[model samples]
Target: MPETSRPAHPLSADEALRFTASRATETTFFFDFDGVLSPVTDDPDASQPVPSVLGVLEELASRVARVAIVSARPVSFLRSRFGSLEHVDLYGLYGLEVWHDGDVVTEPAALPWVPAMAELAERAKAELPQGVYVEYKRLSVALHYRTVPHLGGEVERWGHEQAERVGLRIQGGRMVVELKPPVDQDKGMVISDAVLGAGCAWYFGDDMSDIKAFDALRAREAVDPAFFGVAVAVANPETGAEVSSAADLTLDSPEDVARFLADALPVLAR
Candidate 1:
């Protein structure tokens, strides 16, 4: 369920954007890359952000206190896609890594788990089904069954077994399961810390992992009603309904998100 009951009549996307823009200089915007900025793809490497959204984010970074990408992808991967925006920050591996000022900062606690993750990745490649895509991040591993949907259950089972054997944490997503260091860090923790001193914060996401981010926003509102937080979910065929139901508003696609942000520029300017 949503942290707050749905309003009798919810604010439209444009209305929500304008409301957040009202506190432009004191606001922060956090976005999830896959399925939000970029369409979720079978080949994760092929995913790319909507062209117009990059320029929009650059503009937003100048107006807002912070503009960031909080994603499951590693900082290196995110940098490959969005490294050019100097003002945009990247929090990858669900906050286990960050790209700031041309340098990659990884959570020190997770560094020791690199060897474990590497071994798990190789094991996954050798044991998982032929169609399963194994993505190996230094701090985590993802098993993607998007190409063979029917194998989702098997892949998930395998991932959990591996996690238990290695004492790693499991994060489930759209036809994918991931194993990461058991560190006490996630999107929720990242957002909770980032929103400090900001009058308004907006989080855009498209999966179950992002619910934690929305919950962080709600937790803030609970403590301080004056703090305005918006949870926007980008619609997708899978997990869209569940994620959107938890969000304050929903946009149909990444293109819609681009246009939504672009439209808010003038409002923030005023």
Candidate 2:
């Protein structure tokens, strides 16, 4: 079950954006890459941010105290897709690796997991279904099943078997299962760190894995309601139910996100 199973009333986008605008400089904004910024593609290789999204990110990065792109993708992939945005901090593989100002910093402790990830990737390539492909991220391995949705169960089982043998953990996302070292970091931890000392924060995401961040916001707000943490769900057919249920707000699509950011420009500018 997701951390926050019950749905809170959806936040009014207008009010939420305005709230963010009011504290623009003191707000730290975090976003999940795949579904929140890019249109989800069956082929991960084809996953790219909407043409206008990057420009919006650049704008927001300039206005917000900080902007981060936290994702399950590898730092290389995140760099390739979003490196041009110099001001944004990019965290990949759920924060085991981070890229900022052209330098990529990977957790030194995660180095030992490299060989196991490589081995699992090779094994998955041979053992998994035809449409199921493995992505080797050096410190982690992800089995993608978007092209073969029914293969999700098989992939999950195989991932579990490998994780136990390799001393790793399973992180499930939309039609994807990842094997990574049991790092203490997650999207929630990332959000917690990002919001430190900030007046307000907001996170936008579209997967069950993202529930951790929503729960983090809930945890924080429960302690101090003045420190606002808004959770925005990017509506999608596959994972919208759980994501929206946990989110304080829901946007229809990546295009809606782009529009939200675009509309937010004037608010922050003034």
Candidate 3:
């Protein structure tokens, strides 16, 4: 981990490890798929969890009471990626969707926003900067500006403008800007609901939107004295500092995340 990060407030690494070791099975794990489990790629389709990450998740799912992924990606996408991992819960589009036991559960309010989403997709192609293309997921749209690094700010500004016009909210993730319905769902709400009865909860992420989830973990501790939460931020050049500053601990990369999980098995087993 880099020594430059200024975490908002976090348990020391030793303290967090000791706490998790104290009550292994009572711990619930939450992770963001992109930049946490899988390295961020220029092409989203090219992204997949490293083999070590997949194996570690499989093992953790068997041992932990709950292991969930709450991400901006759609339920269908998450289902395809993590469906094989046993005892894993998938919440996509933040909390607007839930894919459990192979069934998809979506909020009713999201349906009416479909037409507007389509219009945004069209406009993105016709109006946005070149190399800044729109990825149309059925329920939402993501404007990717990764291939055109210099146009990031312009794409983001345009994304926000379009989202406002379409009455959708903007979720800023790695190298992309997502436009989705202004529903009451987000990573924060997802974690808040999932951690209800958990003795300890950990959320690992590496994006601007993930800060909300990190805050949720911290907030739960204030409400329940015995609740232990760990906010882990993965280091990336763009928003790594911000995420790390808000996290309990910072890991160097997806490889480190895999190693962390693989190494923690024994500690958790104890």
Candidate 2 lDDT (Cα, 0 to 1): 0.83
Model 2 alpha-carbon miss at residue 165, Å:
2.0
Q: Which portions of model 1 miss their true places by more than 4 Å? A: 1-10
Find the candidate with the highest lDDT and give its number.
1
**Per-residue accuracy of model 3 over 1-270 as CA lDDT, tens digit each:** 212222234457766766676777788999999999999888887778876887788898777788888888887787778767867888988878897776779899998988888888998899987788688876789999889989999998998888777788888877898998988888998898889899888999999989999889889988987788899999999999999999879999999999988888876776
Q: In candidate 1, what are the lDDT values of residues 87-171, reduced to their tens digit? A: 9999999998988777888899999999999999999999998999999988999999999999998998999898889899999
User: Mind giving the per-residue lDDT tens digits that candidate 2 earns over 191-270?
Assistant: 77767677778889999989999988877767755666889999998889999999888899998999888888887665
Off by over 4 Å in 3: 1-9
Highest TM-score scorer = 1
lDDT of each: 0.89, 0.83, 0.84
Each candidate structure's count of clashing pairs = 0, 0, 0
Give the C-alpha lDDT of model 3.
0.84
- Candidate 3 to native Cα RMSD, angstroms: 4.6
